[model samples]
Target: MKKAIIALALLASAGIQAQDIYTPGEGEGIIYFLPKTQIVVDIIATRVDYKPGEFGLYANRYLRLNNVSTRPETHWEIKDIQVRTAGIPDSTKAYIMKLKDKSLESNIELTDQGIAKAINTTSSYKEEQPEYKLQIPQKHENAHQYMTEDILVAGSSAKMAELTAREIYNIRESKNAILRGQADTMPKDGASLKLIISQLDKQERALTESFTGVTDRTDKVFTFTVNPEDKMSDKVFARFSSRLGVLQADNLAGDPISISISNSSSLPAPVEDGKKKKKIDGVIYNIPGKGKVSVSFQGKIKWENELQITQFGYTEVLVDGLFDKKVNTRVVFNPVTGGVIKIDKD
Candidate 1:
């Protein structure tokens, strides 16, 4: 008898453990929809404000059900979520809250006979409706300077819209937090610039191939020349020019470079909105043995005089022992344009 009782107790414990395992079922909350579920919600409104004592800015967004009609009301469920900002500077923190105190009410009327019949009839009804809210907080000394009003929810799978929304919110929050901490000490020069240049080189190389062949010369010196006809597009040129400007602003003693645009051919047609797209041809030259570098671009001008103005863009550079150091550099057409330009080396 004692052995039988012990065996029965052991079996009961195992049965409890088996029941603890997770399984999907109706009316089981958001966790029930962990596998093969589809949900769609539209944004209703968003509110953001600074929470001074808490050391962060708080944002609250409300979403409404968009696909509730596809599934039975009792079968709908929501799961856990994460959130983050798209391109903001600071990291944000997100929390999900369930509003249990709210309820939906409906009005219906029946005649005297219908009311008496409904009282005698027994029917099963499940109206399990719930509202959820997500709270996001961002921490930054200058959070207001970079706050955005837009929120995006990217789905994990085609069916996991609610989970995606939650995840995106958490991601944005975390990114904002990281940015808040690192924004002040972000690198202004040196390796960052080097990496940017390296990436640009790789991208340019992928777009076009460079040919190399040894020239038959008796002298020990080796020389290479890049033709301007292989220059990149105007947009690429503009991007390089902008980067150079940023470098100059950061380091005035840095290498000096100039870029100009000109179109010496036919006059361009005026745009429909009274704007004209000017076609320009420019050259970036590295002057040997000279401290000064010049960039020349020619294009048609509406000016009273010259049909083609050779706009001279000049800057002073410190090229001391640059050639001897073998500082590898490559100038390619802007990826936006297919025009090639000259690349100079000592």
Candidate 2:
């Protein structure tokens, strides 16, 4: 790929500006490619599924749980959408810096992908991978563990539910007694007290679910990548459904999540000189253009940001004469944006 990019750059430059351009006579030189930005969208969605209890239908009559759903159901909610940018090699912006005359200096450094990083200096680029704290969905606590002997040995679900409800009430009353300092046995420290109260609340909640039913919530992430060459509006990036959660853009069952990108570059358009005669002896790099990216769902904007997009920008030159001075010239480039980071003489 590097060889192909170098060959293409050489051919293109020769055809366009052969008179002014300079190339290494024969031996080795440093070659590098600029980078184009790739936009990444991570859509985070949460799914909540409800499972009815055995006695859910009798909840209102027995335990006064009027809100307990008798039927099982599943639903999804969009949590958030995160946007970020990454750089990839751009073959069209490849360049070669002749090193035949400069024997002592390994002056130019390029990334593994041949994107320029530092000139007359040492540097490295390491892309950091996002770390996700694993969300291992916790298994629902076994309701049987907190069940009383009466509830366990009951002949019917109704009897078991009644016993469980009474047990839940007892646990709640005990917690209240501990909080009020009226329990027979109290903890000596604040930590112990909190632990005791927490355990009681857990037991009560688990037992009460026999009548109120259970809902489990889990999170999911879907990613989409876009490489835009021009302005785009209302592009469907993904879809979402209340019943099926996140879906691909082509899925017809879900609603569309639109993405829009517009060139926001502030750089003035380069003026074309009528004369074709040109001479170039320089290191060329891009002045990355700006782009505004936004995501919309249900006609409301969810996220928006501006990022440096190399494909939208124009190339500029850094004359090779700078390094030929008596003092060494040091320069650094942002490999992602292909823009100069720093320049110094030493």
Candidate 3:
């Protein structure tokens, strides 16, 4: 009997934890696709046109392609491509890197049982390359050979040759020193070879940008999915962005709930523990009715300050040792920083 009670208690606690983290959705869903661009190339043409999709996605946004082009380039070279949706932050956008042929260029093959898995990559080198450029200047050397008898100065005219030899020796010494050091030691991480790599990066970026307005089926595959309804800041999107292409929105229900703050927002800062603070971060339960709640308040407010609550289908419940000595609240936690904004009232 005691074991049964303990099991029941554990089940109840698990339910509450799930409720605290459950995102608002009719039925949680994820969209998956084998996104591919069909590229067309002319036999006699010198260039081929690559066309990818142009639509920016919002949660619940529906897209279907029926008659796409079907031309794959056999002789064409692949450029690593990384792109982002407008109004999305860099911290959230994933970009392609061009260090090697297989560096994070695209991620379209991560679907499981009909769900798109997210893939995340970040660019660490931005703007610093321009500040410091590495250039390896060419050094030219002319080979010279002389007999031992000719090496000794024989007359007044030989003095001019001696002076010229001295200058040549100095130049050769400097050039030889650089060559010897380079031969004995490996290249620095960001010096000569790195400069070459940097040039390749620039070219790759240019190549990617050149295809910005592609209209061909270049086999460029896949895009991310985002939930427009989730109210959490950088957090909500970041969570959805964990695996490569952000989660696809095909499985989302209802219309896109967010408009301007539309798709994503900057996450709320974490409140210090033990600091008396008021927050509204998680779903709230209406005290009057049992409806689940979401707050659209632009900013936090105190009891004396007018706050919008009841309008969003939530009835404020009073609690001890919280706001107003009678807190109108529910669980408030920041999903981005993984911290509770305030202790949920019992």
Candidate 4:
């Protein structure tokens, strides 16, 4: 929890055989575990993607125009649900990708103030004026008017990971100078860094608490339905998507936020479980690949660090089927802190 010395000890007991897996500047933080969703498959073996419904990224603001309170109401299900604790920025302040497909745009319009806007269609353009007013309808042999979309809003993506990691570090750095100044007995740059640090910590803490307080961790759940012909099963699905909620957004920089989703049954068995006495283990993995990984994690503490490093908590496992040969790596993480600790892989 202090510095390199403590981390080194944790490494030794953790027993990770892979390389070091720590980010440079990210400090301690909370890692909120969102509820997991179930995906039903057709017992097939093939890559797949699915989307259940729509998702929105919104910001909250209350205003009193003419001394009258005015803030549009939100869905009762998500009234005042915290998406980004620091408040979402206007279009230019941050990267806003409303929809994934370049051709398709966000159906949910927004005002310059970050409020929802009405959706309307543009008049059909014409190269020439119509000779007469008329109406026409195209006919199809057996076509049904349904709809389709290209983006999987809820699944994990590189952009989402980058945003999450940056936000976590932002929360850390925002309070870094304050703590440093307190130790020196001189304000950071001779300014009231303590006050700033206190404010930032409060906002970060509230954002974090909001994540743990969510009532609908997983909703609109159905199944990870797959192609009827492709073999699909719990074993065959091969974890194609994952997401970890971030409490807020900040401008600070840090390493990419990475995580592996797993269940109790999926955790790896201890190396000598069947033949020898049980030993302490680390509860983290450092996976570099993006495809399916047989992730297993838990903790008993006192885990041995095979990397000859002084890391306090650690464990290792071999990840295979990530394109080709297996990769050797070890990692450890504290759920209470949003730190990945390590995501190393050979």
Off by over 4 Å in 4: 1-158, 182-191, 214-346
Query: How much is the lDDT of residue 176 in candidate 3?
Result: 54
* Tens digit of per-residue lDDT, candidate 4, span 1-346: 1111123222121222121232323332111111111212211111112211111121111111122212222121111110000112222111121111221212222323322221121212211311322223222111011111211242544433233334435667646745654343445453466576665566554333222221212222112221111122122222212232111113122112112222222333345546764432222222211112121112211111111111112233222222122333323332222123333445
Better of 1 and 2 by TM-score: 2
For model 4 the local lDDT of residue 271 reads: 54
Candidate 2: TM-score? 0.85
Per-residue lDDT over 228-259 for candidate 2, one digit per residue giving the tens place of the 0 to 100 score: 65679989978999999999999999999988
Q: What is candidate 2's CA lDDT for residue 319? A: 66
The model with the greatest TM-score is 2
Which candidate number maximizes lDDT? 2
lDDT of the candidates, in the order given: 0.22, 0.75, 0.25, 0.25
Which residues of candidate 3, in runs, are more than 4 Å off?
Answer: 1-174, 177-223, 227-322, 325-340, 344-346
In model 2, the worst 10-residue window by lDDT is 11-20
Candidate 1 local Cα displacement, residue 43, angstroms:
48
Write down the TM-score of every candidate: 0.12, 0.85, 0.15, 0.15
lDDT per residue for candidate 1 within 96-203, as digits (tens), equals 111111210001111211110011112222223334454333322322222223312322223233333344355454445444554434445768645644543443
